[model samples]
Target chain A: MTAYALLVEYDGAGLVGWQRQSNGLSVQEAIETAATSLNGGATPLATAAGRTDAGVHAEGQVVHLDLAADLPPARLRAALDFHLRPQRIAIRAACLAPEGWSPRFSAARRHYRFRILNRPAKPALEEGRVWHVPLPLDAAAMHDAAQALLGKHDFSAFRAASCQAEHAIRTLDRLDVTRVGEEVVIHASARSFLHHQIRNLAGTLHMVGLGRRPVSWPRELLEGRDRRRAGQTAPPEGLVFLGVDYDPPLPWVTSDRA
Target chain B: MTAYALLVEYDGAGLVGWQRQSNGLSVQEAIETAATSLNGGATPLATAAGRTDAGVHAEGQVVHLDLAADLPPARLRAALDFHLRPQRIAIRAACLAPEGWSPRFSAARRHYRFRILNRPAKPALEEGRVWHVPLPLDAAAMHDAAQALLGKHDFSAFRAASCQAEHAIRTLDRLDVTRVGEEVVIHASARSFLHHQIRNLAGTLHMVGLGRRPVSWPRELLEGRDRRRAGQTAPPEGLVFLGVDYDPPLPWVTSDRA
Candidate 1:
């Protein structure tokens, strides 16, 4: 069996997110089904860099699946996209994986982006693509407050109750919250996170931005560690998985195999 | 009767253009209904600087309306917006016109903007707001070709067959086409335009960008007075009535009444 790493982009509005669920549609099921169509028999099972919740979007989601076919990685990728097109998920790039390569355990970092529309009016065109908040927000105050929560921390106070992480201790490499025009763009990078960790932090920042919580609130929440002390979780609509990183870029050529 | 000028903004998808249509809803009908609701009496008549076509958006549409009430101009404007909130067309501002103000007759110049989305992938978020053409366009060629048709000329070939203009001779103040990333923004201004003039120009330019026509094609079309000679009219979705001009330096207020 050969392992392949595939990069994917998708519109999450039509999805139940990255995982397969009995309730509705998902990106994973679509890709797996598409891959299975090319392989003739075995249903393709993929492991992603991370499992995102319902309503979350992704521009660069990395996944890997072992195939029992002689078909090339590029051909496999193209075939998968052909079948996945109806599902709104696209396979951007696909290549043979390095020795023992896996999307989940082999990733070194992950990045996420959250967009906030900071206007009194709703988005006329980008309706579901952004979080439309009708109230004015102080960006500087939120940025200053966010700095206190940087570096290593046991972020339980900002962790969701449904979080299944083995430990709450994690290192946050960067958390930049800045405003561009009428929208707020939040960039966050980390090794990994507890369930809804980044989303919960967004909620805390929104609280600080609106002057509901003091600027030093995030640091206090980190130190507090009580689940009930966390700010309300931000909605899933505005959050997106931007990318996943692994050191030593793969030298495999995708087109040659196809 | 006191005449008031109003600056307006609207999402054109819901409008059957600016004129009253027997087939469906029009921007004029929407505004007239709201104007009548703001004050008790009869429905006021509304006229705009330019009667934009169906699916053509506008960020700054200049209009004049006569109200038979003692309502403050600001309150009249705000109340109209409150009642018109259920509709897509919004009254950005309303003010008492400086004596002898007429939306159509007093206008010295008019400007129109046409946006072209040239990308391989469709804009999922901006579906109805833009016109998506997948083919790659040569922006420099389009710009060079556009200059040949600039200046005073009998734009007979560019004017629609049913254009009501008494003469085809009109001086074009400006005709510039530039690129912004994958999109091309065309800016053209004149004292006034013949019906479907800009759309006709855009259609011919599109052919030049695609290398289907020579740089002199736009000039050739303008020199030829036959409507059947020009390229097809561009879709209305990608166009916007950017702004209308009056004698400037009047406090820079966006109020409809200058």
Candidate 2:
């Protein structure tokens, strides 16, 4: 059996997160079913870099699975995407992972993007895809305040109540906020994140953007390490799992084994 | 009665074109109903700069209506958007138009954008928003071919079968094609266009991009002035009404009556 990593993309609307759930469809189930179909009904276990919540989107999500049958990278992607029909999921690329490389672990960093449509009127073209904050937001102010939470720190204040992480200490590599046209985009990167950490950070910084809280407020919340002291968790619709990065970039050469 | 112009935007996934149709809901009917609700049950006629086909989106559509009850520009926008409820249409801006101004006839130029997802994988995040062309596209080649259609011309070759234009003579102000990441964006501008003219132009240019036809093919088709000689009309989903341009730009100063 050979382990292969698949670059994935999906629209998370109407999905029950990335993991399989009894209530509704998940991105993982769709991919696994497709992989199984490709292998003639042998179920495959697909693991992802991030298990995102429902209503979240992914432009460059990464996943891995062990295949009993060896196929070329292009053929694997084409066959997988063919069976993943009707679902808003795509297998962008398929390549061999270095021996035991796991999408969940053995990774360097994860990147996320949160979009906010700041305007007096609600979004029409980007309704469900963006968080419509109908008030004028100061993006520059929000960017300045986000710096307070950068670097290694205990992010207990931003942790979700249902978080299962062993510890609250994690390093936030980047938090950038910028205005593009009528939208304010927030980009967050880290090695790994506590549940709802990015959403909570976005929510807290939003207060500063709206001039409701001072720039020092998020710092105080971080130092306090109390979830209640932080602002509300931003909605899931606006957040997108951009992708994951590994220390040594995974090499890609078309396998001769078709 | 005072004439007010509105800058509108909408996601046209389920809309039945801009004009009111007996078959399904239309952007015009929605806006008119909203206007009637604001006027306490008097239907107001709404005229758009362009009457787009079904499934055509708009980022900056312009419309105008004569209101019996005058309100401030901001208030007018807010009230209409409130009444327009639940629909995926947004009144981006509302302001007074010069007396007797009509959105259709008073416009100097109309701008449109066509989006093509030129990739092997189908779209996930932008499913219904773009035309997915699986083959690799040569954007530079397409742009070179598009220059053949710029300036004044008899566009009968690109006109729709159902087009009601009295004459086929029209001025083509600009046509630009550029690659943005994996997407090829085509921008077209003119004082006006025949029904499906831009879509046909895009379709013809697409052949050039794919190397199926030479760059000189579109110019030859233009010289022919026969609709059958042009390529197929591009899908409606990829088209967007960017906005309308008016000479001596419409004044937006608040009226004293409002």
Note the DockQ of each predicted structure. 0.18, 0.52
Model 2, A7-105: lDDT tens per residue? 888998999989999999999999998888666579989999998999999988888888887887778887887788799998777788887688878
In model 1, which regions exceed 4 Å deviation?
Answer: A1-11, A29-113, A169-174, A177-179, A189-199, A226-232, A240-258, B1-8, B34-36, B62-115, B149-152, B165-194, B225-229, B249-258
* Model 2 alpha-carbon drift over 4 Å, by segment: A251-258, B251-258
Candidate 2 falls in which docking quality class? Answer: medium
**Superposed Cα deviation of residue A229, candidate 1 (Å):** 4.5
Model 1 steric clash pairs: B5-B256, B5-B257, B6-B256, B7-B256, B95-B257
TM-score of 1: 0.77
Highest lDDT against the true fold, candidate: 2
Relative to the true structure, candidate 2 reaches a TM of 0.96
Residue-level lDDT tens digits of model 1 in B1-258 = 677787777778978999889988888888888888554668888899899888988877888788877677767766776677776776655667778767777777888888887754444334566666657778789889888877889999888887888998888888888989758888989888888999899888989988999988888877777889778899888888877787741122322333
In order, the first chain's TM-score in every candidate is 0.95, 0.96
